[model samples]
Target chain A: MEVAGLILIVIGTFFDLFGTIGLLRLPDVYNRLQASTKCVTMGTCLILFGFAVYSGFSPAGIKALICMFFILITSPTAAHALAKGSYRAGVQLANQSVCDLYSDKQVLKISAVMNRDVITILPDASLRQAIDLLVEKGITGLPVVDSEGVLLGIITEKDIIEYKTYGNVETAKVRDAMNINVQTLPPSAPLKELVSIFSQEDFRRVPIVEDGRVVGIVSRKDIIKFLKEEKK
Target chain B: MIEFITGVLLLSIFLALYRIGMGPTPSDRAVAIDILGILVVGFCVIISLATGRDFYMNVAISWSLLAFIGTIAIAKYLEGKGFDE
Candidate 1:
């Protein structure tokens, strides 16, 4: 029995090793996570099972069993954390991504604070790409625009979550998927006004428009940062 | 044999620590540190078994709890909120 247990442990170790290698070698974050999570989890469980058998009814076996239970609880949680981290970090998926999971239709037509530039997205942009942009830019919202740079709708993280519940499917297009009506703020608005907006409204972000075009985007965080810098 | 395995685990812990320290983003660091904590728990379990100690089992349990609490706190902080949030 002990000999059989040792063999199981060895086999488990090999599986874990291969998983780690896959984690290191995978080209994209999503694929890496998929490989590592499945491999390491199953590998670790088998190893613990082996240890349990090898140690028999002694305290060692009990300890091994407890460890296995803990692993079972935490491994998938860890994978969830990693996947969210990758998404929040703006890690891009490879070529096959089709759906845009992070766009909001309500807040399209955004203005950038740094050069007063506008962020526009087409209907066909994948949800993954939109999410990647949000993560990369650290922005809370974006403007959904058509090929003519005409504002169609807006998308935000909240929209993404809502959409996920609306469809059991993963595929969605921005034009068919965005909120048509959007609220806007002009560049001439005062800082105090922006603060009032936050207090009075549920939105965390707003677009600053000038001359019928987006010039800058302002968020609650940006306002807080501005105040902090001013205090210094 | 135990010593050899222990040594290898330590090496992996160091490598994981490096990732935590050098990760470009907050999430990367958070994940690495969390994994390292799990690895530490694994080490404690192994040590308890090898040494035939009931005391080490208690220690392992305490360590696991502490690590869990720490991971939760850090994750909350990363999310821009505290326990209440």
Candidate 2:
């Protein structure tokens, strides 16, 4: 039991160290904020849990658990309020940042006769390359992928265009600018489901994922093409 | 094991303190302070465990509560508001 407790403590300590490194190293404030809060909170909670395990259900362990509970509840709530407050207070990214949330329309103007190849950007690719892909491909966004073609996230033209951080946004890594929270679909889903999903959000495209890798993308134009074929 | 926990917490405290000192804006500092408060609770627990006492846990509990309240207040201040509001 003591060994188990020691192991948990050691792991939690490592988490805390990594989070601090992220806080010290990450270029942008938003990234720094998220990395620190996420890792630090988890680390501290784990430490408290370790103490509980070490001391058993005695008063000390119980107090440790109580502290852990307090931390788990309050930390995230505070971070959320802080994030929203920061955004509203105009604390942009590390540079002159803006989140033009309302300005762009999700107009998927690609022709129905589309190539199925899903364009992707590497995590390490400069945001400049991402912009070029968007412009050259005449598309609004591209999914970010690992070497294995695994879907990581999506970067839109808007993300790079307005992001003034770390340097010229062009020089910044796509990993920083890309939106990790992307909507994706499996090819097996029904077309009606796909259409309904498209109608639900402002994103112009959804990468088709199979076994965590991006195989294709579905855009508004593809939906239109599907409708045209159905009419026959 | 306890020594390792102590070292980690000490390092974390310094890092958070650095953030507070060098944080670009008030909000950044507030975040650093928030992190510091939570870290302190863990520190108190470590100290109590090492010292063979239960009083330290009491301190931890109170400290945790106070830290949460303090963070809430600081966050509000960052948003440009008074404490009463």
Candidate 3:
């Protein structure tokens, strides 16, 4: 048992040493976190396990077990938190990085692809008027804006369908059928954030706002187009 | 045998310190500090065995807890979204 424990400890020590070396040699903060988190956690846990094996069922062995469990739970979590925090804090990735999925390239910004000539409808516009504009423009949705172009809500085909099922479409107003709680993104937000929103939420289109006015709109088709271009 | 293990652990600790000293980012330093804490815990366990004193085991347990907490605190501070935020 002693010999086995000693061997384990020795191996673990090597892992710890390698982790330190990687930490020193890795190019960026993210890579360093990956190295240190994996190597050091494995090394420390192995050492503790070896200690437990040598000490048997004794109190010291039990303490070693507890320490092993603590290290297992805490080390990786701490590394993840630190990495996320560093990313959020705007720490630049290494220049050698081949690709950055989260990078906010100017080409991927909302302002780059969004249609600036948004065909919008006034809140008081009749459902017939909204439908005519949507059909004429061949669009699935339209932004409901005030006279000053401030976004009030969004009217989509789904809203029109729901409104038609309930009562007379001729009497219904755009505001009556439009979704009031609209999700808007800033023009400068990255395409990655938009992708996540599209995946997680039911929004088919996201309006881009600048200085409290709707500057442009991005839809699912726009994202598909962007991604297709990105592949090239 | 224990002496050899101690020597290796000490060497690793020194390497980790070198990282902490030269790490470019706060997260790198935080990782180094965490590795150093783990090494300290290993040292404490080995000492307890070599000296045949159960008291050292208790110290090891406390040290490990402190190290974990310290690493978490440093990580949170680096993240800038602490409890105050």
DockQ of each: 0.11, 0.35, 0.31
| lDDT string, candidate 3, A1-232, tens digits | 9889878888887788788778778899888889877998888788888888888899889998898898888778777777776776667888556457765754356677777788888999898999999999899999999999999999999999988888789998898999998999898876667777899999999999888899999999987887798799
Question: Model 2: runs farther than 4 Å from truth?
Answer: A95-232, B81-85
Distance (Å) between predicted and true CA of A80, model 1?
A: 2.0
Question: Residue pairs in steric clash, candidate 3?
Answer: none
Chain A TM-score across all models, in listed order? 0.46, 0.48, 0.56
Top candidate (lDDT): 3
Winner on DockQ (1 vs 3): 3
lDDT of 2 by residue, A173-217 (tens): 899888888887766654545566678778778888879988788
The models' CA-based lDDT, in order, is: 0.62, 0.77, 0.83
> RMSD in Å for candidate 1, one decimal?
17.0
Candidate 3 CA-lDDT value: 0.83
Ranking by DockQ: 2, 3, 1
